[model samples]
Target: MTGRLWPRGLRARLLLTFVLVTVLGAAAAAWSSAGSASTALVTSTERRLTESIAGQIGAITPQLTYPPDQDALDRLRAAVGPDTLVTYRNLRSANGADTGLVTAALRAAVRTRKRLVAQRITAGGRPWLLVGIPIVITGPDGARTPSGIEVYAVRDLTGVDRQIDGLAWSAAGTAALALPPAVLLALLAARSVLRPVRELRDTARRLAAGDLAARSPPQGADELAELTVTINEMAESVQTSMATMRRLQADARRFAADVSHELRTPLSTLTAVVEVLATATAGMEADARESAQLAITETHRLVRLVEDLMEVSRFDAGTARLRREEVDVAGAVRDCLRARGWLDRVDLAAPEEVLLRLDRRRLDVIVANLVGNALRHGGPPVRVAVSASPEQVRIEVTDGGPGLPGDVVPRVFDRFYKADAARVRTPGSGLGLAIALENARLHGGDLTAGNARGGGARFVLRLPRNLEGA
Candidate 1:
């Protein structure tokens, strides 16, 4: 819940944190000042009251008789003020009003020590201060003794409390005043911090989107600036590496295209020579005939490899064009199987007449490659099924094999990738599935390979029904 409520942006969180800290600091200072001032005011008031009461009693004591009577007590109370209590030998001041303000503790302390003692307390929901002073007699020898005369005074502290409360409110006001400035400072700080971050973010996004030229400008000699510099250096390295890779790839493709183009004429002459040799093999001796057949077979394999490379070069150079036609998909698959002499070897489960507009030659090539791959690499009982939807047509080919290896599935359609590296010689030039996938994608469709549920390798080809503008 706290995570949900907390600010997600750096600037907002920074501002909130700054304001809270400022307000809390101001409040703490205000509270301390108020408490200290309140203590000083109360202490000063208590001291002054004690001194005044003592002075008044001392000035009037000489005029009263020793072992003073009611008249002396009444005179003492009148001189002290209306809130004073003067008592001697159980004769209390008749006119005093706040006698209850003095606690028994204060009275006992004053009587035992023969000195002034004061206490601050609350009465009638208001603050009050009580002072108890014991009068003493001095002999001719300058020795003092208790005189059994005590004076008590009560002073209201309501005014002091009001002053303390004002101080507290003033402190709170100061804390409140600190907010706007704190927020303003926070905004300035956030701008300074987040500017470089925003630039870095934009630059990183551009780099991810393939704009290798993107770079962030360093702002100041801080951690963020250092990070910006590092990122710029990394981008420079990546740009250099990508440039080198692209040059190498272009050169490699050009070399393959050149080789394939150069070999086509000689390969044509060789094919003609092999055809003549095939006709002459029946008349030659058994050993010579077998050697001639092996030579012919290798020459044909070489020719196929060169042809496949040429086709791949065309794809790489973006010269492969699609010729779309409205054709029955089932009939095309059947024709592909029949032409390749695989009609009896595979099971077909296609509808009689599911039609789509697509490149007929490309579809033929795709089906031929898939079925041939299954026959060459997988177990027997190959299955081919054709289906159609409103948007696309699907051709699924499966073989009763152990299924594609987990590591091989990902790279099955990768150009020239083979599962068994040690078994280098195979009938395929290794470009069959790759070329098939390219053709499928050229029609705005896709091909996928995986393991089938019934335990075999499965290849599914999906081509869009409409090839208009594709």
Candidate 2:
């Protein structure tokens, strides 16, 4: 769950990582440059000041009297430099009242009469260098004695501080300028990398959704491009396999249709011969007459079965064309019953004005097959009802009989499926409901079967009102 809080997209994660790296690199660069520049400026300032102050001290010391009057010390301070402070123990010259920058240890070191010492210190929140040296004044004799004059120079470092601050700001600004270019580079890199991945994902989704033709174009010669090529190859394989399967299915259906068509001629001739034989059998012995009648009945059933097979083949081959015309639902239903001599057998309940643009022949075939199926397999009081809405038209057939077994309802409209699993001889070819379903689909509609409310089988043929859907 903690991973949910992380960014879900690759681009955002890449951009964030790039930005962090950029900022860290920039900050490091700024810090390094600022430190070097500040150190250099301070060193240069110290070197120049030390040399100048030492030269001035050398020139002024020999001209001074040992244990000099205050006037000599004042003149020594003036010769050092502007904004420079000089001190000799309790005696000082030129704005000497402010002496806080000098520490007690530095004053003691100067009293030792040893070497020159310099240290940086802050006075009144401004940087200053404190340099101290003890001078020996040679008397008129050939002997030298300590002058006890401790000279101090406090050099103002305000200008050096300002220069160092400016350098720091410049370094920061230089680092800041790098961000725009870094951001642009990050965006370009993310786009170049993620575009192909997005395309491949979309293509994969289309393939999953049954678009076998979906493919991705290979781009660069790198690994991503190789992946794209692999995906395209897989899609082509699927397309080829599906195409072969479809062609084989079409060939099988075509063979069945051709065989059914070829058998029709011989079947017709055989039917005629059987009819003639039936007439002649009336004069023959009783057992021979019974055999002739049995042959005749079997030949008729075979003829019907072959016709149904041909019809199914035509639907499979997409050769079944609709003859669309405006037709009243009630009229279509009534005509379907009358053509089969079943008007007196079934009750019709329909709306007079409900109409649709659909194939009349297919409609009649659908109604006849359903009514015949119900009558042949069910009890009396077969009822047909036609209903309509703005979007669809419906015809429902019901019969007063035992409803279908629970397991048979779902597969009742499958081709060659039988409600009775036992091999009891039945008149139908087991394709009546299947053909009716195909006819309904031809009109861009559907067929469904279930039990009616009063314990009977029900078949509803629903057709869309729009013929353009076909």
Candidate 3:
């Protein structure tokens, strides 16, 4: 419950904490002051009342006869005032209404100690002080001896309580007055502390969103300012690093594209020469024919590598464009399989026709790569299933073989990634899955690789049904 009510933002929490500390401090101070003042007032009032009663009794005692009668007691009580009570051998003053204020404990203490004692108590919801004093006579040797006559007086403490109450109210008022100032200070502090934090937060957000140049201005010379400076330095370092990385990537892509272009002409001439050699190998010796076929095979692989590299460069340079056309997806998959002479080896599951707006050539490329990879690396019973929804088209190609290794699934679409590092001379150039994924992404779709429930490697290619709309 407390967590739910607590402020979530840094600024609000800071402000609330500041105000709470200030208010609590003020309340504590006020309470302490009021308590101290109340204690002092009560102590001083008790002392003054005890002394006044003692002085009055001392003055009238000299005139009274020792072991006096009722007359002496009446004179003593009248001298001490109406709230005073005098007793001599069970002779209490007739006007003894205030006698009830003194408890038996006070009377016993006064008689036993033979001196003055006072007690403050509450009666009828009003404060009262009961003072008990035993009169003493001076002997010739200057020694004081107790007189049988004991004096008791009751003092109303209502006025003193009122003053103490006033003091408490004043303290409360002072505490109340501290509030506005505390709130104002809290706001100022919150602004000073949270300004840099808010700026830093915004700058970090911009940096995360790819605005590498984003920075927060340093404010005061404090820890937060130092942090701001550090963050700015870090952002600058990151910006420099990113620029260097981008330049290197661009140069690498350019180099690949340039080399591919340079090799195209020579490769084309070599391909033609290899074709002539292939035709002449029929009459050559067996050893020569085998070597010629080997040369032809490697040359074709080299040509394909160069082409795939060129395609990757086009993608990296953002030069690839889509030629969207209404294509029969099922027909395109079937045609790709037929062209590759894989029609007899693979299984096809599709509706009669599933039409989509897509690039025909890219679609064919995607299917051909997936199917070819399955045929080369996977077992027999390769299956190509096509399905369509309003939003996209899905094509799943699975092979009846061991599923992809755990570590290989994540990098399956990465260029030049091979599952077995030692098997380097596979028919694939290692760019087929990568290129297929790129083509799928170009159509605002995606390609994913995983294991099928039936225990084979699964490659799913999802393409948006309407590229123009996408």
Candidate 1 local lDDT, 48-134, one digit each (tens): 877888788889888878899988898988887778888888788845467767788988898887788888899999998888888
lDDT of 3 by residue, 152-187 (tens): 888899999999999989888888888899899999
All candidates: CA RMSD (Å): 3.5, 8.9, 3.0
Give the residue spans of candidate 1 off by over 4 A: 45-115, 120-128, 148-154, 277-294, 405-407, 453-455
C-alpha TM-score for every candidate: 0.84, 0.56, 0.88
Q: Of 1 and 3, which scores higher on TM-score?
A: 3
The 0-to-1 C-alpha lDDT of every candidate, in the order given, reads 0.90, 0.85, 0.91
- TM for candidate 1 is 0.84
- Going through the candidates in order, what is the number of backbone clashes in each? 0, 0, 0
Model 1's alpha-carbon lDDT is 0.90
* TM-score top scorer: 3
Off by over 4 Å in 2: 1-186, 201-226, 277-294, 324-326, 338-347, 353-357, 376-382, 399-412, 419-425, 449-458, 465-470
